[model samples]
Target chain A: MARARSEERRAEIVRAALEVIAERGYRGASLGAVAERVGLTQQGLLHYFPTKEALLVAVLEERDRWDTSGGRDRERWRLDLMESLVEYNAMRPGIVQTFSALLGESVTEDHPARAFFTERYTQVRENMAEVLRAEFGDELPGGLTPERVAPLLTAVMDGLQYQWLLDPDAVDMGASFRDFLALLREDSKRSA
Target chain B: MARARSEERRAEIVRAALEVIAERGYRGASLGAVAERVGLTQQGLLHYFPTKEALLVAVLEERDRWDTSGGRDRERWRLDLMESLVEYNAMRPGIVQTFSALLGESVTEDHPARAFFTERYTQVRENMAEVLRAEFGDELPGGLTPERVAPLLTAVMDGLQYQWLLDPDAVDMGASFRDFLALLREDSKRSA
Candidate 1:
């Protein structure tokens, strides 16, 4: 019963964190404010998650937790899964705004989330390379090595987010992403 | 004497605003804190700029004020000029951090700069389409119209910035961007 109650409480806190991040962005969000929203003191919140970063990770993880498919093998992030996530973000305007704001916030100096994102990108880059290598062997179409194309994949994903967030009607992430993927495969059929 | 004094005072305030933004980011920065830095109250700060957003615009304008070439025609943002700006940003990590932070904060709801960035991107898309049309004619090298390719141009530039800012050592913005440009011209030679 205690375990169930704790799980329930954690869920509530994650919801509040999402709202807080949506309101003030990840950098602007504070553990105290989130705690207050959940009827817990800062100390009480700390009991659940040791630091703001931990809580933020929980909130971020929660975003992916309920998705169609995430963390399938932990290390190997499939391309289709990424496409689905982009589609999911398109449906959720609030989450798109919140995550975009968080990425923007993390680029600054000494931001609490700065380290988190920098490390996240590094990991993302490697995972992308791994995924590309797995699917395309050593090289993708046009002799573009997996290592060379990994950053472009992530860049297109994130860059499209900024544009989509600014104007949804003008740029469609799902469609635009498919077009990009098509560009990569433009030479693949010729080679095959 | 009064004109000179006011100009000098504005310069001081812009400098202070830069420091504040570096420390606190654009959203976290307060006009009051900025005024206090230059030994003035909020009212005095308002007298100079009227609103926080206006001050921020002024501060942002100040960033481009001393650039080698900006606002050449006010409406036309040249591709090479943008490339130069990327190189310049690499030289100034402080400026990159501040601007990247600003963009992040602007994507959220009701942020003072949110409207500005939204409008800016709308304008950027148009400008890019115009630039692409001017260089590539109505149809680009691979049957991709400027209208279709405009977002990709902006996407790659902005996306690379995110990657570059996250890890400078691994990604070279200047080199990577030129490569992207090369990819665009890939089909031009064949058609010609």
Candidate 2:
């Protein structure tokens, strides 16, 4: 019960932090506003997160966790990954906005999310490459390695999201994603 | 003389504002810091920009002007554009970071920069498309219209810059750009 309760509170704080960050932005967002959103005192909020930066880091980590959850079979992994990206962009637009803003501000060597994003991207690349390697293992197309293609895939998804956020009606993301997949196929064929 | 002096002062304020925003973030960035940077009083700084939001908008506009001017010619446009990107990233990494963070924050309809970004993007797309169309004239590639391709190209560049900033050594931007051009060439040939 205690562990579950703590988990629930942490989740609550994370959600509240997102809302606050979304509403007030990273810099204007305050511990007081976060506490007020959750009906907690400032002290109570700090009990879970010692600083505003810590709270921001937690919010990013939570997002990274939700994003990095790998639950698809190897055969359908690529589709599953792309679909998750589409779904995540649709569902968590606020987090996307907040994170884009954070990426700009958090450039210091020690910024909490700096390592997380770095490691997260690396892990995402490795994991994605693993899935692709598995899918194409013996039948791998072209000489394209997962490592080379993975970052580009990540960049395209991220790039598409930024565009979508700016003008949703402008781009057909589904078509673009399909085009990207087709390119991968072409690359694979060339290598083969 | 008065008008010229005012213009120079405004330019100074915008420059200082970018520096301040880069250092303290958009929300944390204050007029006082901007004023201090320009060796003026906060009241004097307010004389130009009026508010923090205005200052941010002005900084962005200034950056756009600074970045785009005398930077590209019809021939070697691709290389010139890439060099501009690399130069911008190297020279004002912080301001770029701040601007991106601001872009994420300003998406809301009422956010001060929302309309600015929206209008800016529209103009950029149109202008870039026009340039490309003019350059290619009667021989424009396949069904790949400039309207369809310009936005994607811009997004790729922006996304690449973000990745580069996160891990400068990790992303070989120049090579990736060359690869993008090569892909475009292949697509054109296949279409032809």
Top candidate (DockQ)? 1
CA displacement after TM-score superposition, residue A127 of candidate 2 (Å): 3.2
TM-score of 1: 0.79
Off by over 4 Å in 2: A1-4, A15-39, A71-76, A108-111, A131-145, A171-175, A182-192, B15-30, B70-80, B130-144, B188-192
Candidate with top lDDT is 1
Q: What is the lDDT of residue A149 in candidate 2?
A: 55
User: How accurate locally, in lDDT, is each candidate?
Assistant: 0.74, 0.66
lDDT of 1 by residue, B82-164 (tens): 77777877776666666666777777666777776677778777878887777778875445677777777778777778778
Q: How high is each candidate's TM-score?
A: 0.79, 0.76
Candidate 2 chain A, which ten residues in sequence have the lowest lDDT sum?
A135-144
Candidate 2 lDDT over B72-105, as tens digits, reads 5444344356555655565566666666666756
Q: Which pairs in model 1 have colliding backbones?
A: none
Every model: iRMSD: 2.9, 4.3
TM-score of 2: 0.76
Local error of candidate 1 at residue A93 (angstroms): 1.8
Error of 2 at A1 (Å): 7.0
Question: Compared with the true structure, what per-residue lDDT tens digits does model 2 show for residues A98-139?
Answer: 666566455533566677667666676777677766656633
**Regions of candidate 1 where Cα sits further than 4 Å from its true position:** A1-12, A15-43, A49-54, A64-76, A135-143, A189-192, B1-12, B15-43, B50-54, B62-78, B189-192
